[model samples]
Target: MEQYDIAVIGAGPAGLFCAIHSIGPGIHVLLLEKNLQPGMKLRISGTGQCNITHDGDIRMFFPRYGAHGQFLRPALMSYTNQMLIRFFEERNLPMEITEGGKVFPVSHKAGDVCEVLIRECQHPGVDLRCGEPVHRVENTPLGFVLYTAGDTFSAKNLVIATGGASYPKTGSTGDGYRLAASLGHTITGIGPALTPLLIRNFPFADLAGMSFAGLPFSVWRENRKIFDGQGDILFTHTGLSGPGILDRSRDIRAGDEIQLSFAGPVQCDTFEREFQNIISRAPTRSIKTIIAGLGIPERLARQLPDLAGIPADSTGAHLTAAGRTILIGHLTACPLVVSSPGDLSVAMVTRGGVALGEVNVKTMESKLVPGLFFSGEVLDIDGDTGGFNLQAAFSTGFLAAQGISKRVGKRT
Candidate 1:
């Protein structure tokens, strides 16, 4: 078996960074990845723009990770989004900041980011292998042992950065969870998150292309309100999706009904004035038809008469004050009965992974499994889109690599 100073498994962001940080004279470092090439997921993130990190104060960044926010606070502050941007820029790969302070490559290519990392990990002290899935990990008296296809390797330190199970097409496929579980590490609950919601709302059908661009919506879980976000939302045949919808997806329960709030970015008083304006202009049209044209879709518009207990064909002149009042209520906060969550393959990230308590934040190392460090979505930490996920991978990977260096030294 080849004995190395450090063996980092899963050539994703965390593993690659660990290898890069471990590089120095006389160090024996090996990086193993199951995918045919490294950064497959990175290549597709941000639609290939590779939203690497968000430019913001470290304080606000913590809440974005939810409960795991605290664990990441120290490492996140240490590496920071500013530093990651510099790390790439120093490699001649400049980045650009966009809406929501999201940072991306200048060419909007995730491939460029991946290319730079691969190049950086190519020093003599570092060795990288892809298309290799780790079969098992054995914790030795000193260091650790890793078994992969056709070979077994030994090292004094190991870092696992296999990413999350979401986006299996990128080769995440839950392999990390399996490998970590085998090492006696507890795998936290995992579920598809940042995915679109499927709905049974008929109006959403007609409003399929209609988007409340950067508008806000409230997501309800049973009778309790769960999550609220302000951003673009699009009506689809399935349900609802877009930046805002994806943001609130994790808190959404199976039986929740997604509804747009009237008390949203557009104020209720303003909506009332706007609604009355339209109702007065087209008394010739059915009150139902008139309201449909007021930012509500035809499919959803068609259902107003039923909600108001007035016939769809009933004229505006025929509608009493009661019918008009009832009609407005339905349009203001239309309800969408949710169906199952979108498939995991299409999801952007996983909501849950390895619990935070089990991993050391300063080192990004797993206390339960010595030498087994984790980063990226494999840990029970996920953030909303707009460059949060990529940042976590970059920051945590850097921290984990730094930890491995201090523990194992720079050489074999």
Candidate 2:
């Protein structure tokens, strides 16, 4: 058997980073990838541009990872967004930040990001073997033994950096969950995150390409409001998409109610008062014209009156009190029922993985088993869109590498 000081499974961002940073004298690192190529998903991030990280203070990143943000503090603090940018910059890959604070390479190519990572793993101490998928793993007093189709390998330390179940074509097939479960780790309820919602009887089908910025919205389940936030919302042919819907998709489910405000962030009472003032000021103006003047898209404004059961040509002069109330309701809190959300096949990230309680947050090591660590989406940590997820992956990988290096040093 080929013995290694450390063996990392999956060559995604996490695995590749762990291997790269684990390089040291007398430290043999084995990086095994199932696919023929490495960084398949990384090559396609940000629709090929690869949003590498978010541009901000590291402290601002906590809430981006949802409920488990606090758990990633140590890892993120150890290797911050600034450090990540510097790592690539030192390698001659300059990064640029978007207007919305998303960081990407100056070349605007995700391939460049992958190229740098793959090149870094080419050190003499690292052995990157692609197309060598491990069938199973066994833990022994000596350490961990991996069984592959062609041969078996043993390592003093093992890191499972296999990604989540999103984008199966990129080789993220929830294999890590199975591997972790086999090792007596708890796996949480896994589902799709950062995916679009499919609305039931969607009304804005004709305005599929329309988008709203900073549109305030609320989620309600069985008449109880569960969440309230705002983001950019896009009208899709089937339902809704864009950062607003995708970021909150994890909290949404089938049959939940999504209340949207086309009139920005105004309260119901405030919006009604302002709208009534508009009617008093322009009693003869068409209702559609008044709505369009409120900064709503003309296309959507034209449909609102019809949806409110008022004539498309009705003006404030002829509008009834009941009609005004319905129109104001639609403008303020238009409720849309979610029939379903995009499935795992189209989801950008997986919401759950190995339970956080079983792992050491400071070291990314398995608390139940020594010499075993985890990183990336394989852990039950999923961040919002932009560069948060990738940053988390890289941060965890760096921490795991540090942990493994210290352990290996102690043994040596």
Candidate 3:
């Protein structure tokens, strides 16, 4: 039986990097990947552009992960965004930051980023085995035994970076959760996070490509407004999508109300007065014509009268008091009842995973099982869109590598 210093499962950003960083003069690391090619998901991130990480001080990353942000503070601090930028840049992979503060390779290709990591893994003493799916993991006095389809391997330290359930086709079929659960780790409420929402009986199905930029949006649960933000929204054939809606999808549930204010800066109190002023100026114009002139998309503006329950051909001068209120309300808060979250198969990331309490934040190691570690989406930490999740994966993987090396170095 061959023994190694570290066995990393999954070849995603976390596991691959963990294996790369853990290599040393005496350290022998084995990387097992279920897929034929590594970084399957990374290749498709940011529509192939690969939003690598956000550019800023480490403090900006705290709130981006929601409640779990503080848990990620130590790992992120150990490997700050600046350090990550320098780490890749020093290796000849020049990166650029966009206006949104997202960092990407100058090549603008996620494949290039994966190529760099894969090329670096060719370093001596590191064994990367592809098309090997870890069927089971057994804990032993020696350390851990990983059973793959091909054969079995043993390692003194094991890192499970198998990722979450989202994008299962890419080999992130929530295997890590099952693997961790088998080893006595608590799996949190697992669901889709950065996924799109499906609206029930969506009204603007025909206006699929219409997008509203800087739209003020709100989510209400049982009449209680729970979330509020401003983002660009895109109308899909099924419902709504885009950065704004995608960001809030984690908080939304079936039967929740998603409101979009196409009226922009106009408030309800002022909307009626402002609308009336426009109507007074163009009393002879049809309601559709008047709305289309307000810079709203002509296709969506044409449907506004029907959405507000007003006569489509009614001119501004023929507007009734009740009709005016309905139109004003509809413009300010177009309500859409959510049917459910987008399918997990298509979700960009998963919401819940192994609970945070069971894992050591500083090292990305399992608190219950010694010598067992986890990183990336396999853990409960899921961040918002815009390169936060990738940054978390890289930072945690780096820390886990450091932790394993430090612990094993003392033993050697």
> What's each prediction's clash count?
4, 0, 0
Candidate 2 structure quality by residue, lDDT tens digits, 1-412: 9999999999999999999999988889999999999999899889999999999999999999889999999999999999999999999999999899999999999999999999999899999999998889999999899999999999999999999999999999999999999999999999999999999999999999999999999999999999998999999999999998999998899999999999888888898889999999999999999999999999899999999999867889998888989999999899999999999999999999999999999999999999999999999999999999999999999999999988977877
N/CA/C clash count, model 3:
0
Rank all candidate structures by their TM-score, best first, as comma-separated numbers: 2, 3, 1
**Candidate 2 lDDT for residue 160:** 99
Off by over 4 Å in 1: 262-317, 409-412
lDDT of 1 by residue, 139-201 (tens): 879678888878999988877788888999888888878878887878877888899988764
| Ranking 2 against 3 by TM-score, winner | 2
Candidate 2 minimal-lDDT segment of 10 residues: 403-412
What TM-score does each of the candidates earn?
Answer: 0.89, 0.98, 0.95
The number of clashing residue pairs in model 2 is: 0
Worst 10 residues of 3 by lDDT: 243-252
TM-score of 2: 0.98
TM-score of 3: 0.95
Better of 1 and 3 by lDDT: 3
Q: Evaluate residue 200 in candidate 3 and report its C-alpha lDDT on the 0 to 100 scale.
A: 96
